[model samples]
Target: MKNQEVADLLREIAEYLEITDVPFKPRAYQRAALVIETLAEPIEDIWKAGKLEDIPSVGEGIAKKIAEYLEKGKSAYLKKLKKELPIDADALLSVGGLGPKKVKILYKTLNIKNIEDLKKAAEQKKIRNIEGFGEKTENTILEGITFLQKTENRISLGFALPLAESLKDQLLASKRVHTAEIAGSLRRSKETIGDIDLLAASDNPKRAVEAFLTIAAPKALLGKGEKKCSVILTSGMQVDLRIVKREEFGAALQYFTGSKSHNIALRNKAIKKGYKLNEYGLFKRNKRIAGGTEDSIYKKLGMAFIPPEMRENLGEIQLAEKGSIPPLVKLKDIKGDFHTHTIYSDGRASIEEMIKKAESLGYSFIGISDHFGHLRIANAMDEQRIKKQWKEINAVQKKHPKIKIVKGAEVNINKDGSLDIPPAVLRSLDYAIISVHTNFKMGKQEMTKRICDAMEHENILVLGHPTGGMIGERKPYEVDFDEVVLAAKQHNIALEINSQSKRMDLASPLAKAAIEQGCRVSINTDAHYPDSLEFMRFGVGIARRAWAGKADIINAKELKQKS
Candidate 1:
């Protein structure tokens, strides 16, 4: 199991312990789980090195449990807890705003075993009758249920991408498989995907299919055939695999890796040219033509090769036809990350650690944009602490002359369109990233004005997480995005595409709009831990989906030169 999976299991154990009224151990487990999740090295590796207790917050008891979990597939303590609770803890906790205490109340009072039971209770008005749950709470529960149902079939890109890669690797290892690739929405880099689609080029389709089944050992076989196979993984993710001859692989890939609208557009183009386009191959007057490669297929259609991310029927076809499709920003285009946190704020790693991580990633520069003092919950830095951080950053700069360290703060935007940091202090930093941390209920006009006013500040270089959204959990705050985009253009401030999995803010659509408005974007991980900096790839994905090229992103250029 992966470190993240182990961490999640431990976290679930903590939740179940809390619900069961276990004292002290629940909080201990919680702390250990957090450390495990953020650890740079795998917990299993630590255990193999016989240093399980070396992990912070992990003590003898927790270490033993972790060892048991890693050695076997399950933890004895966790299994015992599950047997005692006899409730679907994950399902109960999946409800938005529902915590261990709430789940306990529901389980003990209403006999709510899972989501279905909770939904029934809410619908029958039984939830309101419970001591703490009012009519408002009941309605909120219903809304959360509806949201869960809507997103149940979909998995976040971050979650699905790695699994797809692992599957592709397994397929490619088979002697019968010549080439393998993940397709569908995943290939398009969609933020969320319903299922994983895999395509392989192989001469022996039956052997390839059998090898996949043997390696995957899926929980259930949904279907099986020489050309196509479907299965449900142990993690409950559905996967579909298709194998085709090397000669027809390109056409099959194009057919399957489709946004329905994009495929329809291509078919229409083919019809106009008196040709036929399908999964088998592109045909002209019953003669097989180009099908061996994606480039060949596009060439046959007399168009430039459109990137999968741009194949959403969003004017990409026209651009391809005219051979004017701009180059999309690649992960390598990012020279630095302008928004990151360290121990000065709510971040887990120290400034030196973050800089080292960035340097290891081959970054020429990195920014330490920790939270400013206004965010009390994060224990954000005050003026004195900010100056102290700059001192430390300067020292690090001297030590690591190869990586330019940009000193900055993520200043909170107050309700009245004012910044939390004083103007003089903000100006002292190399640059400032302004963001909204609270007052999300402001009307569209108020929010827009608040952001626009912040952008007007001389020190602000980028607006972080411009939409103030947490995908699948919270909706974007009300704001006139057009006004914000225009303001960003006017003030020469870049809008950020936050790379945090939960908040891919300035989401692709808004990022595209910002680019069209002559506003550049800053792709930042908004990373709290050094490891989180790797999320930059997700930000780049969003930029590509927005059709943003290197020139459209500020961080793609050297910050020192711009300064």
Candidate 2:
């Protein structure tokens, strides 16, 4: 397990202990464990690197524990906690408002252990009569239990992407496999993926299935088959694998890797051409036929090849037929990021730290567009604070003359859709990224008008994360994006492809429409730390899917200018 994961488990145990009235000592252990977990490097890495003392969280006591784990493979304290604490650490979190201390009472006194036992106790009214468990608490626990059971296990696209890439390597190495590629939500770069789907071409589907089954690591084999198999990883992520003959590769790939809407559109298009489409292969009426490649399939339909990002039935087919498909943007074409946060805001890294990290990643310039005063909780700055930040960023720039530092702000667009900062102040900066932070409940017309008002601000060069939704938590504001994009183009404001893993906002189709309407894009990492700058790939990926090109992005030529 990763060091952070181990720490998170320890924290959960501590929370449970707090609720259960477990001895005070357990809390200390949990605290130390959390500290160890949040360190930039893990205790194991520190020990391996011979820099154990250098880690901020590794005090002498924790350092000794690290050494023990390194030498003994397990901690004595961890074992003891598990043996004594009968309560399921994670289940304690299910009881709303009743934390670790209360959890111990339920476990030790009421004999409640897991969610099942807790639910039984609640159903029987055994929990309500308990000393600390009130009627309200009982209801909350039951609701939480139901929510947990109904909740589907999902993984972020960022985490699943790497895993899919690793598995693709393994599949490609298999003797029977001729071609393998990651597909489905993963290929489309969805913000959150349901499961990973991999498609492979081979002569021996049996051998391919066997090879997939034989490979092992922290995975629960969901099932096995000649054509398809599913497995749940230790991280609770599901992955599916499908294999087919080389002749059917293209058709199978297109069919299996799909958004249902996209597939239906493609199928309908094929029907118009007198061809039938399915997972196995494409057929003309009842006769079996073949399209050797994706290009051939598109050519057969009398259309230009469509990139996977444009696969969604959002005028892509029509655009391709009219020879007006937007050119896809690439990672290499991005010259700079217009919206990144640093220690000046809620960011974990300092200005110099973020600059060096961006430089290492081959970027020519990076903007420090931290939150403005409207988001004080995020350490948003006022004018004076921003002036101080400018001094710091300027000093760093002098030392690294090759990389430019653009001073900017992620200024809040208020409830009525007005820029939080005045135009005079906004114009003083090199650039501005206006974003909505509140009043997301507005009607579509109001929301569109609100954003349009912000776009009217001449100094606002980009709209940061146009959709203010966080995956699984909030729905995006109701806005007429077509009108918003039109307004943006009129004002020459670029739309942002936010690179934060949780937000990958301005999704492909919306971005595609924006580009089609002549509104340029500015792909950015709304980075809060140096390491997060790397997440620019997610934004770039969304832009590529939207068919954004070098000419469509503001910073695409800035790096070349520096060179």
Candidate 3:
């Protein structure tokens, strides 16, 4: 929550600066915002350690603003911006095609202050009549509104997971919780989550519940009970906390950390063995048999313990019964990350900082796959710049002897289905990732063929964000997964499970399907900054849910040996 609070303020500052015609300052705030949003550690902790300036792109000024906000409950600069602009920059900026300039035009010309106002303007054809906005742009705004509306009530996993974990830590810190675990879809690592569920076993349930309410400082209380409580957080996210005895903790967790169907199947299996399964315990005719642990219950029921992410009742139960559950890819199993960006592109951090961070993580290698070719919006590098970067990388590699820094580029696949980089240039690099940067409106056949045609290039190592789905925002471009997966297999290109919170592309099911078809997939953070390197957890989680073992992940082994 603290991280997001800071990130939002940074983003708002960026939007306001851009709206006011300030140059360079807007991108600075934007870069800082990206870093904070993707950080694995809590922002408050960094501030408490007096190391805010150490964060990527956070200069002394930005650090002061962050520290000021952390100390006080608000940002004075943001407050001043709001007073001057009086515009809902956050809401307006959320619309896909609307930038700060467009937002300013809408606000000044049409009195459109927020998403609702913009929607009304678009619907009434008022925006199209305005200069610069034609029918196409206005129509796109309406579509963005519709897309934004669909994501109401649910929050992205990127935001939800950290919030849940932080709350759980607070509970433990209160010295009231004996054991606590997050449950529900949040535990399952779903791309987007509705409500957060946390279960705990406490010696003093009343005291534990009281401490939780105080730490959470909920916006509103929904209900109250002896050991259970529900409240709305400041972010308007619903969180539920339940306390149980230590013996029943595992049982309660197993019951509540379910996908309904998985639980139902478990009960049915227990019934066949003349046992009862419930939140309390698995019981015989008169005595308790298993309840002390989740594994105990599964073991008693004659099945292997299923991982929480795989408890979706999608053939997992059958596999568990057969003791054939595959060992899913773990975060620790990853040896290197291939799809990272640095300052040579639009990334916030420099190449040296990225390498140092990777080294700190004990990574054996890190790929500097900055944006390349004609994607000008990304500040892509040309051939000369690529050559320059390689020299810098070569120099940096000498200093970091333990880690192999590979020079790579995230090349764009043009409309005509050819890579933007020349063949000669592509042959000189460690690797290249082909992605669709424009023309998302292409039909499925055209889009699939375009990507597949690009896949034929021998220089390509991976298909970056195969589906290009942005969670709760832009839908994936039209493309048949089977054909794309087939092309990837034929071309020996690994599909990337991009781990950006907003773009957990290669959705778990599709990733699983690709693996089932004997195609290897790479789990990458697609990190734009050093801190975002932590987002690798999201990709690993998705891969786990996809039932991918370490062997199924490209980065989990020696890179050259995989292909």
Candidate 4:
């Protein structure tokens, strides 16, 4: 899954092009980046198959660049762009509202080349005096810089997961490694991670370490040993790989993939059962009893195997002991995703492309839930546009008969407990997902009432990203979620487990609480593009971590037509 690595390079190139005022190529590179990141298979594998141009939005020109990246792990065009700009694009982009254009202006006008310069300019009121930047924008830049400072060490799971999996896959392919899996917080599917931990088993530890170094192509080596190695990835993520014997593999993986508290609980349980537990194996009077497999160790402990995500010492042990750990929802349980966007609104892809991607995912149905009404900034559809989209959907359905293309709209919950989309227009929609797009500073009572009011409307299937939390960007808005959950249960509105990486709102704990209150949830990618539909597994991960079952998820069943 060099997919992420290549996508990042393409995005970097796009940023450079945008800064240099290169027309059209920037958008092409941006689109290609999205497609690559969302690819189902590894980009390296795709290049190996000699079908680079077969990728959507990848023309002959982009294909050559991708091939270059695949072969040399560097793009000549990207290198040229970097030589031209010589600026840290990612640092400036991290500011809330700054884009490449603004970055260019800052660099050209004020010689603000990095976050430090930008921060100083904002603090000294120099940015506000600039032509394009205002006082408010200056204040926002300061706030964003503060946020970045607080979270500079934390890496979003969205980036870490794919990059870690790519490294894991590479290790396995080397043949020196018998098995390899990413461990640590990444394995638990936390929204943000610090670093990556990989555990593996191999007959030849020295060969495995050498293979990892070759595959990583690290920017710098932190440590290297026969059985243990550490390096810094190009993405600035630190990866530590450890190799062990085949017999100790499971225990080693479990040991490394720990929440710390879970291992403590397990060790206590092992002691009570007259067993000594460590990375080697579960031992009974110094005689190794179980270690070959994770399931074997769990079975020896008189408990069911706990999922890595649920190993947070969050009441999982009791269920494992009862041998009735609820059957957590999986990605395979998803029948369809009801929340998606297209060119009708702010989405990157068109309606047909979205439908085709859904079909490729073998979805029974896919909802085109574009922004509607007060979301004018997103180019949201009005009555006429909604009807036109319905017609277009009707026509597109003819070409794709295997999956049902349900027409839906995402509406904003007004502060006065009303919906932006008129009820008359909503009736024509197969479903409506309501969200908090504005007025996020409302008090808890007001926010809860607003969300509950909208859920009372018919065909309102989901409360989209109920918490409105964006990882490292925005905190969840103040809302009485308990009250909201009660209302959802009363009205049968499903809580959404939005899996947008940065916005996995109605986070695991909230989803768990909703499920415990007998309110169903719908795990959706909230995909803005066909490639991002790949985020469904991350949503499912949240559900599983919350101990949700297929029955607890609404889209696990067939979708019925609205009208």
Candidate 5:
């Protein structure tokens, strides 16, 4: 973990303290912690080097606290916090739609401090009776807790990808194992994964299975056996492993790498061929046969091997019938990003650092579009601040001749379905990206009008994440795509494909619809930090799935002249 991660944890501790009514000191510590996290230097190194005061947020008071923590291997403040607040305060907050206030109420009013306590309170109907808490909220909290317990708590695709790779490495290292690879939704590159699947092959299945179970576990083991093993990591993700013979490896890999619908279709294909297929192997005439290679099975079914990414059953089979599938888009094809934020708003990185990071990745241009007025929590700037920012941007552009910095704003779509900034103010920007940030209650027609009103403005260049939904958090306001896309086409406004792992907003179908409507696409990493630019993979994956080409995406070379 990095110092920033620790800093974030400290902030959470502060929030919990505020809710628990711990004191003002904890909030100060939390603020200082966030400041330290945003600093480029390593906190541990600074403490060891006796230079705590050099950190921007570490003043005399924080310096003393750091000294105590470094010397004693703990902080007195944190110790007090842990004693006063429950250790699982953050876990309780993870319950969908539950805030710190509610968690605090459960702890203080009902003596509920952990999941077990909360569940017990809910079961006894104690939570619903609390002041400010009602039956509906209680049921929602209970459902959230159950959902969190049942599913692997979500992690970024970047975080999960390495675990899958590492497990494959460990399994393949065994002498008996002939092949090992990751399968399941992960192989298909879904934006979110439920559980990771591992498929392995060996000449002696028993030895391979035994070896797999005996492998050292970095995370807590949930189950261990011959054919399969399941484990839950410290981060709360579950992984499953399956072993098969070398000949059956390909079929097993494909079977395990299914989006259920895709697998069902494949099974139907096999059925039509008078054969049976499954994760274990393929069979013919009620007898095991051709269970080894994926290519062989596909050949038997009169089809070529399909890429894992194209297995979403989104016309992939029909395209395969024509012996054609769109070429996969790669990270290299991305030439710029549009919807990035900086310290001007609620971003961890600065404009210089953000532009440098993108330039380092060989991007020719980057748009610095921080939040516009109305997102007070994010310190969103009004016209004056944005105008001042343009001066700084122009200077940076002059200094870094290799890259172009497009001055932009993520203008809020206010409650009345209007851009937070006036039209005259928006026109001053080199580019303007209209986004839905609040007032999501409006139904399809109203929501469509709300976004279309902004896109209709000639100066607005892009629509950022048209539907403001966060997976598992909020559902997007329903909208008329015909109106939204058509308005974008008429006004020559590009639609954004936000590359955030959590919000691959322009899903393939929507992006495809945008393309058909003659609306250009921008695959942007709404990157708040330098590290977030790496999320471009998910965006590119979705674009390829949507049958988009270089000409279709505004950040690709074909669209460079316009940029």
Candidate 6:
């Protein structure tokens, strides 16, 4: 979908508007950009339906700009704004904490136009002398720059997966294309993708390649041949497309959808069996066999089919050979989400709206776990507000009796192993998720004790975003996860796998450790908006990577009332 493309343009416009001292227009554009990002359908589809103005927070002006972008693949006003500013505004804003205001200040004060310039300034200690930036801010900028350098080429799975799916859909539309599938790290469901790899089966390779090239609209055609083509998209993602005959499709898919180690292990197994395995087919004594399907190929090698996510060569092959691979959790296995927020706290959607969205997704129950009083910045619910929220939830329960709505709060864990909310208030709710939102710099022993104490609270049900990492932007806070897992097991508190794209905390490895340590895991979106609920798939992917089964996840079962 062109949703991300349009959102990027709108955000760029917002940044430029902020630099130009425009009143309120920048915020309007920013809000519109956020709304566009969360939209399920393509922005072009909305424009085609003549209902761009129907989108929330998008008015006439932004609608016109979006229409221009969809029709021409560029916005004239955005171009004009870029030309006027004449700086690498996007590059400057790529730093974690560097907002448009900071970008403007850097540009005006030190003539910093890009990351290189900013890095040089920070290294020279010039930024600390600026009006608002001090030594601490300078050090943070340097750290952000380092982080940006490390992750600049790596795109998150959440962003790359949709783009790859769209490309596959476009390729499948062609009459010449028989079947198309994404391969490489994408198929393996890696957290970050380096590039997109696609494979298609077709009778006419040339025709399929032509159709792919036309749809891709490459900024630069890297190469082209009768059976293979490589191109760089305008969005700077490289895609490699290859077309093979139907007979070779499965072999080709298995060969390409690989971790190097997995393929090598499979090849060794094939060699021991006096067979040769490659992209074309598996061969014994130069006679082709077992290339028509992945299942057939695995059967010929005397092993069960290994799921792509488990093909990380992390003992999966041995398990497959032994026929003991456990069933990984699937999206359909989840009965409901135990961790979610609403308009009562930091969430954008109201309680009714969240419940309705969950019902639409076939969930039988959902918990409204909003922020508690400690997260003052989120405008958290106090005693009175909590009572009002429960009253509203009761009203909704009467109206929507088919789905269960559990009232809960995401109570903050204080530094000295105490919960931010009173025990009485916590006990009054259905359950509570005790989380650490601040004081991330606490020492390992202190942090472990704090989390363990929170887990001891009778009202605490789950530990939310266990590690408090923001992917590439921020490092996970220091804590002895082994001790934390032991405590969770002892206290019967579930550790959460937060599915927000930015913070997939309690990441796959940690989740796997918790499961192995006999602590049940909760896979939650920690969704603040209705659209964010869809992020559950990413969480499921992490769980699969962790080799977590349905029974290992708490939310996979029907909701039961706490004693």
Best by TM-score: 3
Which one is best on lDDT? 3
TM-score of each predicted structure versus truth: 0.90, 0.74, 0.95, 0.90, 0.78, 0.94
lDDT of 2 by residue, 1-563 (tens): 23544454456556645654668756575646634533444355568787765654346765666666665656676566677775576655644445666677777788877777888988998888888778977886776666555433555565567667767877787666999988897887766678889888888888888787765343588788878888875456677888887887888777766777888988898898888887766788776676556666777777887787667777788987876777777888888888888778777678998899889988888988988866876778888889999899889999999898988888888877678886777879887889987776688898899899878877788888897865533457788888888898888888988877657788777887898889888888787666667677878778888778888888787844421
Report the CA-based lDDT of candidate 5 relative to the real structure.
0.75
lDDT string for model 1 (123-205, tens) is 99998988887897788788778877877777767567767877798778767699998999988888888999999998889
lDDT per residue for candidate 5 within 399-460, as digits (tens), equals 88888888888888775667788778777888888888777667788788888777766578
**Model 4 spans with C-alpha error above 4 angstroms:** 19-25, 48-50, 75-86, 100-105, 108-110, 124-136, 348-353, 374-377, 398-402, 414-417, 439-450, 472-474, 560-563
lDDT for model 1 comes to 0.86
Candidate 1 vs. true structure, TM-score: 0.90
- Residues forming the 10-long window of minimal summed lDDT in candidate 4: 554-563
Count of backbone clashes, every candidate in sequence: 0, 12, 0, 0, 3, 0
CA lDDT of each candidate?
A: 0.86, 0.75, 0.89, 0.87, 0.75, 0.87
Model 1 misplaced stretches (Cα beyond 4 Å): 1-4, 18-72, 126-133, 374-377, 561-563
The digit string of per-residue lDDT tens for model 6 on 1-563 reads 77777877888898899877889999899878877776767777799999999987899999998998788777899889888888878778877568778888888888998889999999999999998889988998898899778877776676777889998999999777999999998888777788999999999999999999998888899999999999998778899999998988889999999988999999999999899999988999888888877878998888988888888888999999998888999999988898888889977788998999899989999999999885877778899999999999999999889999999999888999889998799889988998998887688998998888878888778999999877666667789999999988888889998887777777777887789888899999888778778888888988898899998998998887321
Model 3 is weakest, by summed lDDT over 10 consecutive residues, at 467-476
Tens-place lDDT digits, model 3, residues 204-258: 9999999999999887999989899999976678999999998887788899999
Q: Against the true structure, what is every candidate's RMSD? A: 2.9, 6.2, 1.9, 3.0, 5.5, 2.2
